[model samples]
Target chain A: MGSLLQIAVRNVVRNVRRTAITLAALLLGVGVMVSIRGTLNGLQRSMKESMVLAQTGAVQVHKKGYLKNVLSSPLHLDMEVGDALVKRILAVPHVTAVAPRILFGGMVNLGDQTLFMATLALDPKREFEVCPKRRDLFDARAKAFGTSADGMVITVELAKGLGAKLTEPAALLAPDKDGALSGENATILGTMQLTSPGERKIGIVPLPLAQHLLKMEGRATELAIAVDDLENAPLVAAALERALGPEFEVHTWDNVATFFKDILFRQDFLLSLIATVFLVLMLLGVANTMLMSVLDRTREIGTMMALGVRRSRIVTLFLVEAAVIGVFGGCLGGLLGSIVVAWLHVRGIEVTMPTSAVPFVIQPFVDVLYIVKIVCLSGIGALVFAVYPAWRASRLRPVQALAGG
Target chain B: MALVELVGITKSYELGRTVVHALNGVDLQVERGEFTVVMGPSGSGKTTLLNIIGCLDRATAGTFRFDGEELGDRDFNDLAEIRNRKIGFIFQSFNLIPVLNVTENIEFPCLIRGDPKKALRERVRQVAEEVGLGKFLAHKPDELSGGQRQRVAIARALVTQPQVVLADEPTANLDSGTSEQIIDLMLELNAKENVTFLFSTHDPRVMAHARRVVHIADGRLVDGTDSGRAEVAAVAGMGAR
Candidate 1:
């Protein structure tokens, strides 16, 4: 066993140039995935940071049926109940921070100009310690998510579309089931910053005013909690479920983050499918190198056979050489990929948007899981590539092989 | 006692509409300590006969008995075992593994035979010394001269101490001087180890070293002697073409 391993190592070393070429292919493939991972993570960070100014924390807990049937239903009547749940869940072992949230949706009218949008209400006092937005993000979401002195902030895009701004009297009208407009009206006290039009797509209001406007007095929409560590999110989620009991559902950052789960999955699958072609090509490069090696040493192999080297052993030698190339390449690729990803995670990729998406931010990312994923896949890459060449080498006839070229 | 025996061995291949007989009902016996030389023109089945004796080919229509075991229809493992344990082959091109040192190249046969460690090592050491490669055990095949390569191949074959060593045109790839050197080494080794050496060659010098000679043409053994030639032609006519 040991001698075979030694021979396998020697065979790889003998073709140093090809081995280097193969290793480079493996590394480059792994590196691409790693960088993609890092880039995505950074985008998420930018999103969450923007969200903290809007909501705070990774997870949110809302009243039963509030998320699914918010527009028309039995509204959560008490903000106190949500506050209690937030306090109790934050007490859960892995839970780190907690904040409350409220939502309001209505049509805004600037004179005769009217636009429909949703609104969210948050406590700016509590938001400061968790995810305060940077100057650029704050300035943007302010127009879409800003609060007024009357504590009603409107999105910038919504304001422009409605020809309404701070201190403008924008009629907040929503239709009840009777086809009669609720006839609610309020002054646009202030304008919120905009990170995304989607964020501004929601009107901005203080919690008390939002509770009044939504006709659900003293009731909050949800409680947001930050956990001690991001990785412990699942464990913390389960614990919160037990603590909150069957009456209220516990949620995590990943849960709401997955509002785009299907979309993300489709995106991920599309990316991986495209990336696999490169992986296959890289594997082919490895297989091609080994096949060429076998062709060049046909006589040597024949001689080995006459010297009583088993056919299986000869095949194993090539396979082992490929395996060695795979293992080394995998490690190097993973390392190179990981370093590149980690760098991106620390220093994010900047992105620009076309003029149409103005007032909406798009951040690119570095996801650590993506790096881990590529490193793990590199081993399988090497093994699969080496199979054909090794089998070919093993099947050579001793007599014909011994015959010189 | 004979080390190997072949009874009515025949082999053929079909090419388009033609049936080519590589070996045709050939019968022969080789005893221990004999240098048997088989000579033939190309496509005359000399190499095919060597392939059969080396356990590298199966006889299509005959019984081949080696050390009391019938050859043919054995699985690859058994056939490989027979080659490793019963016969050692030296090819015309001095088939030494290019990646291996001369000593490791020689030790390969012993390794395949699964000889005990102490025994395998000692055999490799002794063979290397005997083949005049004691100092070149670390040198790969390409680094050695043509004659040295053949000697290394001879050492590889004899290291396992198999029942017979099959040398199929062992000097075919060597220059005249190198070929002479290789043949002399084989003769000296045969004299010392008493290992039966069956060589298939067209080289006159190789035939000179053989104690007994087997001649073949058109896939049938022929005697070059006038009376024997007449008998072979009469036998060929008595059969088919």
Candidate 2:
């Protein structure tokens, strides 16, 4: 250590009780901040992954005018599904899987009760390659899934609300592209869970059955493409648009899910507020401790002043001491936080999200970049707080201080 | 010219609307290499005079000169520079930094002056040996006795090779034996190095070691008529001036 740093160390070591108290405050503040940030990051990651895996996949492909009138479920805007188009999209780099879907809205009747529901028809083999089917997610009979020619799947919440059972008959009433009311009969296969409680009002069936019911043969509303790395979804979407031609439009999950974006915005705002509060509190703690130390050392400071030491050197001395405390305490807190986050990463935290239709589990993630940022923040806060006290010490008159006034 | 000359110096302070005059038109002078003592009772402004002489405090109105340079309007920074390069101070309580060892405390002034590192170590060692603290260089202030601590203070004062060393009651806290020993050591340094010494005290034993005695009472210098020889001569010189 340099002479000044050595002097600061010795002084800090001489007052063990004060040093310990200051260190404790800094340690707890930094540790809690790091852990909280890690947990929030984990929650955000789990929510985004859930939405992508269960609904939008990484990107969605649709006809040029399909999304504008999608709420009306206009069958005239549906794209004709040819094997060549599917093959061309599948050939795009990073395009892991592509599943064709036809979406429609209608009423589901279980004898005494009739409920409005949005419906999705998918190809069993291709859908399984992209997203987990209801049969794969739960225990059901072998024939309950995979192109039974007349099977349907509904959310568990929807089944309970309608008082329906598996292998039972249900009726769906919807409109065809020609403005005719059409009805179809299906047997309930099984039920599954979804992230959004609002999505409970949905049912699923095979693509061919939906085509037959709507009288729009060999047509699909949109194609949901899965990418091996979801982070590269935009690039793949761009490539898919070029390969599938300008007749189609591409939409990433971020554009399709406004709810997730809103939730993320709120989460980030709350976390930032928490971080600011912690930083301010820690800064005050450091400032208070240093001010008291200066009070106790008034005579000693006067002696230095009388010895011809400059005022700036005195201020630098105190600042260096505070920075030392910050570094030591920050490292200790970071280690403790990392240990906790590591434990959560393995054991996982089970969270009951009321907005989710099912139980949500999140394993808290530890971001190295976030940890580094907090450490820097803590160190800088400590220095900033020391400024006032150090300046106060430097301005003391040697005559008054030496006389014990 | 005298090494120190203070003429008509006055200092006052406001304490809650009441003005307290600490120094009142005090005139004094001391030639180079003089071992002088300012003797006074309690609250006689001995400390205030010493503070002004040390450049740690400024006079409210007066013409004060050191080495024939007028210091009446010098700023605090210039006064600090003058103290660093020309004068050394020894407080009555032996104000050594508690955290630093004896050698570090002795070399502290040099460090503030930004002296060369290698030569500063040798000078510090020489001073430590000169003060008979060669073996206690690594000992902190608390580990040493009262007299030993005072010796460390003296070494620190002399380390900068100052032209004058001002001590405020250098023996006020010591017993009779230690006080005599400290006085003897200071006398030896004064004679060997030809360094001027100015100290304040009420003790007769302390005054006995001084070549000239300047008496102070009620913030002004009084004639030392009671003493003979050196005192009467110094008082007569002031009277003539």
Candidate 3:
């Protein structure tokens, strides 16, 4: 085995130009695969973080039928947010914090102009605890708005549409649970700069004020839950469901953002397709090199055969040659790829997604195990591609091959 | 029993629509330790006969026995094993693996047979010394002279210590002096080590050194009492033709 490896290594080194070409192909293919995977991972992670931190926390708990009628903002499906329910939810493993929110549709009156808005009313301290980055969403003027329960914050676009100014008193009118007109007066404390299109006409108020105006003193439409780790959200949600029973529905952020999940699935499919193409190209390159090597060494192969070398040994020789190329190329490519990813991660890539108002930075990173997997895949791919060529080398008739050049 | 035997051997090849006969109905044998040469013109069956006897090829029709074992119906791999265990081959081109140095090249066959590397390396070194390549063990094929390369090939063939070493025009690519030295080396090994040597060569020098010479023409052996004179005449006649 050691001698075979020595011969294989020497054979690969015999033809410098051809081996370099094959190594380059493998290197580029594996490098691109790693880079693409890392960048996409970064993009997916960034998008999920934005969605979880600024909008939905890691998981959400609501009345069993609430999400079914979520678009209508059904007051009848609201759940009681009493101290006992909150304490029960906080008891679930992995659950870090929970914020109860009242979701409603209201109209902000600005003299002759009235603006329809989707609104969230939540306790500021609890919401901040559940979604740490939520504070970043508030504009400069609203930095102190969460301190006072009577103050409200509307989206910048909605405030502009209503011709409303910060610190100005506004009348918010909505239909209460009894279907009667209910009104509340509050000072527009500040504006929020939200990126998503749906949240452009949104407003936020204190939980106490919303509960009073809606005549539901202790009820909220949903409880957004945060877990210690984003990856554990689904497990925590399942535990919450089992703890809270069938009266409430527990959803992970991925389930709540259905469109984003679809986008993620599509991205993964596209990545696989790209990876397949690269694999095929790399296979062809390595196969071509091995076949050419066999042809050039036909007489040498014949000589070996005549010297009592077995056909199986000939096949092993060629396969080992390919493996050498694969291992070297894979390791070097993975190293270079990891370096590139790390560099990009440190100096993040800013991507301006069509739906987002400001560009988000994607910090690409490839873990050690992922790089190892890619290297092994590259090596195995080379071996698979070399089988035909190795078989061809082994099958050559000794007499004919000797007679050949 | 003869160390090498061939009875009524025939070989033919199909080139397009023409069936060319390369060898026909040749019977030959050589005892152990005999230095024999099968001499013929280029179109004769010298190489085909050597190939069959060497187990590198199978005759189209014949009874071939090496060391009293029949090999007429052996498969390719079986033939390979027989060749590996019992036969050694020397080519006209000195087919040493260019990447391997003299020691590695000499030990190639043993390595292929999975010999213990430590023991085989010592034997390979001894064989290299026997072939006058003791000082060039670390030199690759390209770094050696034509004679030195052929010495490497000879070392490789003799390292296996097979019953017979088949040399097909071993000195065909060398100058007269080198060819003389190579033939002398074979004769010395044959006389000293009792190693059987069989060669297919048109070189008169090789035929002169052989204890027995078999002449062939048009794929059949030509009987002559004066084998050397007859072959010289045959060569001159062919040149005239």
Q: What TM-score would chain B receive for each of the candidates shown? A: 0.89, 0.92, 0.92
lDDT of 3 by residue, A200-297 (tens): 78889899999999999988889999999998998998899999999999999988878788888999999999988997898789889999999999
Candidate-wise lDDT, in order: 0.68, 0.82, 0.85
Docking class of 2: medium
TM-score of each: 0.86, 0.92, 0.91
Q: Give me the runs in candidate 3 sitting further than 4 Å from their true place.
A: A91-93, A106-116, A142-171, A185-201, B225-241
Say which docking band candidate 1 falls in.
acceptable
Each candidate: RMSD: 5.9, 3.7, 4.6
Q: What is the lDDT of residue A181 in candidate 2?
A: 86
TM-score of 1: 0.86
| TM-score of chain B for predicted candidate 3 | 0.92
lDDT of 2 by residue, A147-261 (tens): 5887887776678878855556788778876778898887777776666545667888888888888887888988988899889999998998888888889988887777778
Looking at model 2 chain A, report the run of 10 residues with the lowest lDDT sum.
A133-142
Off by over 4 Å in 2: A65-77, A133-143, A164-167, A197-199, A241-246, B224-241
Model 1 residue runs over 4 Å out of place are A48-53, A71-78, A81-97, A127-131, A134-136, A140-148, A164-167, A171-200, A212-217, A232-246, A343-347, A352-376, B116-119, B224-241
Residue pairs with colliding backbones in model 2 are none
- Answer with 2 or 3, whichever has the higher lDDT: 3
Candidates in order, interface RMSD in Å: 2.0, 2.1, 1.1
